[model samples]
Target: MSSGPSSYKIFDVTLKESVAMTPSLQHCVFYSEDVANMARHAPDQRIKVVLPLAGGEPPCLVDNGGWYPAWLALPAERRPPMRTYTLRNVRPAQGELDIDFVRNGDNGPASRWVNHARIGDRLQLIAPNAAFDGNGSGFEWLPPDGVRQVLLVADETALPAALSILESLSAQASPPQVQAFFEVPLCTDVQALDHYTFAKIHWLPREEQPHQPYGQSLLAALQTRLQIPDDAPRTQDEAAQGILRPELEQMWESAAPAHSAFYGWIACESSGVKALRRYLIHSCGLQRETLSLMAYWCHSR
Candidate 1:
């Protein structure tokens, strides 16, 4: 299959420097000759990063039946171990790009590189790739005109996508009320993002205990704050409603009374997002076309 016209571009960017976006978040401002030649990207687009791991670091991209073309044809040691991250923001006019890295433990090379990234750090960035139309605002399920309310959900990995979505929605002819949810390990993990929108943002901190189930806790808090109703059917419907059924139902009900259609973007753990998608489709009766569910980082990926 041929990529008709590559929506993604590859660039070599030198990190002029890094800034502490928050106690747990760092902003890496990078520049590239390639970035200067690229075209403007939609707000929700993302890029792929090719990270070279240190010796003895476990290869994150494995030789799996040649399934990953991006990593194929390279010597094992020098092969780029790639990770996809949302483009937090782009200042095409200034020829600068921003990507936020959560200061999680450096168990992985990407995390390690980000933690120690500094001035003159070299990084390769594939050009911004347009979002899958189905999961993007371009999808038919999203409000064609304007909505009164919107709900955004994601873990730290998905925060960038959520932020971009909110910012894009803010620029619409008439934007909706936006509520963003993010969960990270540390309370200080929260950071000030590009405030190009008029949405109310909320952050939830995940416990740091090893082996603690952060996914379940996030679902619970979201359900409580959203006031998911107690009248949900207890059997098939409940299970079909997915992990956050009650909360999604509440959102649907509330938004309905105001003639508002919601664009629900949930990107997080693969297992968890499967449930969120189920709730949106099976429980809340949301049109599948309107929901954007992405597994930013999956355990099995």
Candidate 2:
């Protein structure tokens, strides 16, 4: 996109490296000559990617500023698979960015690309233009300014984002008391992650003898810790937005009262998150404003 004169632009990026991270995560580094124009707007900075076709990964085309509309106009066979991912790090000076991919050994487009990607393979990324002074969206880790106790729940898909939030929190003057429940595919997937001193991380592996649901461990953990009252009065703000409805395809809400001492962030499979949304608000009586619930993926069993 000619180095992007607009607030956001498409960049042709090369796969610099694809390396292993724990048992379930793949760390990929992409570089582009135009990456120097990309700027990180938030710790949970996310970018949209056009996945390469099978075999040798090739760079895909993004049609102008209205990327989606143009792509949708293309023939079904010509249309490429597109997905959103969080950035692990951005090195504007080096024209490089890192992303953590959760590898479930599935035949999904992303996992297939990761399984076959070569060092020089190419792809497309849409990211913020460094020169833009405007605000960027696609980030949801915003808690109240001085929140104390924080609850983080995620499966492998959202683990990278959860860790990114913790990293951002660590930089604060007085970090919150973070209790993070990270569920992964196996015990070996549990590894050391950088977090603040007050943060206590609990890793749940799916290797348990009796098979449990993906987010069940996190929900059970929270049930014991949080005091879910018999009822919670919803504010007009929440009621107006249908925040009480968990049947939506996915949920993404981030609005916490400034006076709140504790804030919860939950992201995982669609079904699990829907159940969590219901329990946290209706059953547990948690104020809708004190929590941010995001359904990251829907697994079709």
Candidate 3:
């Protein structure tokens, strides 16, 4: 599992530049002469960024310190310090780094910083950190010997990580059959993704006048579309869980009896991911070792 760096100290850094990923997302690039001073980082890892308060200061270190560590070791008001974001890309050789921010507007300091960020802006940085891999290895049960297919299911938040994994997997190994389900607001959000073996990408578009939060409904529909027949004898109570249970049953009903294998990756809203994880483990009889499940973001957090 990951931990704070041995050389834990703040770095005075500045925004080298920023660009638009979408109308609502910005890619902020930062530079530091002290880049070599930080610890090694990993994809999906997070770091804290301090933003100056309105009219409090301009390019000034307003918070008690220039920058503070977030998501780890801090006071109460600062408990959930700075918005936690993934390290999108890094270049140690060039002394540059990039983190993409989902523009949620002034509701958050981090979001606000990104919304107004300009070239040469200054801010504090808690050196790049790594993700916790409590299991002590990479995706242990995947690529089960002789397995030749891959399936990735996720929302926009997990898209970066999913793409990185797919590109790496496609380049070195014989391309595995891949399918992806992505949820995004508009059609333009669809862009070139790395080619994988027999890839089929499904896009679930957001509504103009949203009938409801479309992600939940899309996931519910997927559950309905993938359901197994009721006759397979297992447990009676399995039918009680809403929406996703039948999909799990269907996945099990469709699988081979013995060693013919499939690898699954899923990340999404917390409740939905948790539901799928339970179904994969309990109802489908999938080894916890065989599936990669992550709750990328929570609804109410």
Task: Name the best candidate (by lDDT).
Answer: 2
Per-residue error at 277 for model 2, in Å?
A: 1.3
Q: How far does residue 140 in candidate 3 sit from its true spot (Å)?
A: 10
Per-candidate TM-scores read 0.72, 0.87, 0.66
Per-residue lDDT for 1-301 in model 1, tens only? 7433344445677787688767777778888655555543455466677676575333344323332454676577667667776667767667788887766667776778888776877767765434312222211124433355566777877776676676677677767666667877677777676564566666777754346454554565555664322331123445544545445532121111223344556677766666565654665556543456666675541
1 against 2, candidate with superior TM-score = 2
Worst 10 residues of 2 by lDDT: 227-236
Which model, 2 or 3, shows the larger TM-score?
Answer: 2
The runs of at least 3 residues in candidate 1 whose Cα sits more than 4 Å from the true structure, single-residue gaps closed, are 1-5, 53-71, 129-143, 191-198, 208-212, 227-260
| Candidate 1 Cα deviation (angstroms), residue 2 | 12
- Candidate 2 structure quality by residue, lDDT tens digits, 1-301: 4644566667788999888988689999998888777887776677887886545446467656566676778787777787878877888788899989888665688777877778988888877778776677667777876577788888898888888888888887888788888878888999776536777788888786247776787777777765432232344455545646544534676755766677788889877787787777766667778878887887867
Which segments of candidate 2 are over 4 A away from where they belong? 1-7, 54-57, 226-250, 256-259
Model 2's TM-score against the true structure:
0.87
1-301: candidate 3 lDDT, tens digit per residue: 7343433345567789898876655778889886765553334444546555455243233333223433333444444334445556677677787777767656666777777778888776655423322222212124555455555666666666666556556675466666667666566666566445466666665543265453564465446543322322233344333334544532221222233345667766666676666665565545444456766666663
